[model samples]
Target: MQNYTLLPEWAKQEAVILAWPHAGTDWAENLVNAQHTYVALINAVNRANAVVLLLCPQDEIDAATAALASNNQVLIVPSEYNDTWVRDYGFLTVSDNHKNYPISFTFNGWGQKFDATKDNQVNSSLAKLCQQPLIENSIVLEGGALEIDENQHLLSTASCLYNPKRNAYMTGDEYHTLFIECLGAKKVTIFNHGHLEGDDTDGHIDTLVRFTPLKGIVLQGADNRPHDPHFAELFKLQYEVSQALPTHKIYSLPLPLVLDDEGTRLPASYANYLIVNQHIIMPIYGQSEDKNALVIIQSAHPNYTIVPVLCHSLVQQNGSLHCVTMQVPTNTIKPEIIAKAQLGVSIL
Candidate 1:
């Protein structure tokens, strides 16, 4: 068996990766809006995270560089990708007992729903630029598909992973084997419930719930009011997690605005928050639900300063805060970081 184990996002980080939206992709008409969201995310992460890598396709490389010219806290790595969801196409860092390494897995456009030719080559470029070593694998996976906690338990949803177009041939037990084979996780928790309506990724766990540092979870819950249509399903999901992980704490966050733009409801989820160091970066939609979720999240994490980001435009493409950002674990080290960049490296 491999010695490396996958890590939770709440772990210490070196940097966060953001793939800038350009004029070439679907965000062409709303490129400005996408950038607006990214700016907030980049700025917030820069304060706590050491570096932010902005991936730009060749066509937009010059524009991206100029736009970020004043932001020295970030680095621009010229590359092409079908979309800006780096959390799905970017590197997957796994750590041996000694060090953390980026594991490269094939991303078939979340089961070929979209063109991924450009996105597929992202990690290869990153491996060369950051000089991050790659552990290539054939089992398809995305960074957004799973949410593991500090306890070595991998959490995910069956809707996305077990979809017919993705891995229909594999049994549930066999899929769990890949978690062990690839991530070194101790156990697997696959939820069949809890999903955002507009989420195109087929119930990605990030949009439904997240594992918190307090051995707790922040799940999307329905207020059971008349306006909340998915009350029953969300409530069932809460019970599923509560019963499954009985020893941990649980905080249910109210649903944010069923955010929409141009007649499409975006995946606005408070559960899709990012934690960096002692900071909690949450996406806010300026809805009544936003305030309640923040209070509950803050109560659960009194030690961290909660930073709410206005992500109205960010979700226009059906993904929100956590969907666009990929955290680099602090414990990882590339050969260049030590032998060349001289940033200091130590075996875990």
Candidate 2:
């Protein structure tokens, strides 16, 4: 396989794909809320781009169709999935300006901890739907573990991608070689992130730091309390690493005070906002810092509409907007071709 990296937002996309949640897994108890959230996401993203939704084989697509019936910016394709975390299992797209393909690396439910056999086929099916080549890498790779800059710089955490359980067959250097041959990442940009009590992915970059087009990166900060230890360690680690980056800029967003209900800490962070074509969608917990986070994100993305989705139930699942939604690059096919494809689907 040739080395490849993700195309920038400005790159052309064929369409955005999302896997709907099922009661079997990923949304066992929260299937209803996840469905509503999925609808809202479809509504929002369809404003600026075409959306292709993946549905379970035996599942009813009427709910999605009813919610989006008034809106003509979507297409629902029947597909099967074990979970709704498509960002990790969905295809990772790459292009070289002339040709484009969807990369389908092996997904082992983030190291076989979760049932993922069905989730693995998303890449091939998505590629077949798009009529593009499906690039398959035997190694286990999750989209959540990577953050890239336009300048070829990458950011990742050892706790998530480098976990021994995730890739016991490969060493660190061996993994780097795979990155070079598989994903055109120049080099792995590493940072030391401390563990948080409620964090399940062990420091996913989307929850810890995010790169902004204008203001650089807005990161989650824990500079005050020392009792949890992660407060001091994660805060310092984020600051030091940001200062070290020569080309990219950085800004710190205040981390929300951890929410706990009945002695359980919940994963909460303002960094989990999603970037659509014209809007930056975020989850709101009605906290005082919500305003602050919005202001910061708005200032960073001046051209985008700052959309806040009510995420009370979403946080209970330990992820926010970015964690749930994946952006498929638009303009992948030529404009004339896309226009023809659009004509095939009814305008209703």
Candidate 3:
């Protein structure tokens, strides 16, 4: 048996990968505001001494460099991408006997909802840049679609993993076997309940649930209003998680009810927070529940500092903070790769 294991997010990270927003992406409408959020996110990750592996298009290299102000712990790599949602396309790091292996899974633009030809090729460039031989897999898995605990329990939603658009040939048993073979998951829990309005990924687990370092699971709580559309579904989701992970302590984070300019509900979820080293970079909408959510998250992760960044603009695109970044586990990135990235070399 291969001694492989998918590292949890709380694991020490060598860097966090972020794709810079530009006129080419959906952020073209609000590029300035989105760039501001990216700048803040990069700086926040840097505070924990985690390097930021920033990917920018060749045309935006100078602009991205200027936006970052000081590139102290930031490494910029020029590349082409279809979108800024790196969490779905970036490499997923697995470990065996302390050795890091970066796996590249196929990304089909969220069930072919959008064009992802360029996004699918990102890991090839990243593999050469990081100097790590990529473990290529044909599984249609997204980083944000699954969460793993320290015990190797994999948590995800059935809506995504079982969707016919992504993987039509695989049965549940086949997927289970592949999870064990590729991701080293000791157990897999697929929740049928849980979803957010305006979510484009078809119920990605990151928008609904998460595994924390304290052996706790944080779920996105629905609004208190009984008539709210998500109340019943989220309530069932909480029950499902409790029954599934009976030993874990559960914490509820309030869901912020945010709407776009057209009065469309946006998926503003606190469950989409990113864990980087000793920090939990949380997404906060300018809502009344922001403070309460922070308190709850801090209590669950008492050792880590909670860094909140305004994600009002991010959710407008149907994702939040965690959707835009992917963490590179420690020992995976080489020093030479960092040096080359800092010089803003074109990886593509």
Write down the TM-score for model 2.
0.87
Q: Model 1, range 172-234, lDDT digits (tens) per residue? A: 999898898788889999998877777889889888878878888888887734366677778
| Model 2 per-residue lDDT tens digits across residues 7-126 | 554244455566666666557677787778777776666665555444444555665555554535555567777777776777776765445667877778766777889888766655
Clashing pairs in 1: 98-348
Please give the ranking of all candidate structures by TM-score, highest first, separated by commas: 3, 1, 2
Off by over 4 Å in 3: 339-348
Per-model TM-score on C-alpha atoms? 0.92, 0.87, 0.96
Best by TM-score: 3
Which candidate should be chosen as best, given lDDT against the real structure?
Answer: 3
In model 2, the worst 10-residue window by lDDT is 339-348
lDDT of 1: 0.79
CA displacement after TM-score superposition, residue 165 of candidate 1 (Å) = 0.5
Clash pairs, candidate 2, are 4-184, 12-330, 12-331, 12-332, 13-329, 13-330, 13-331, 13-332
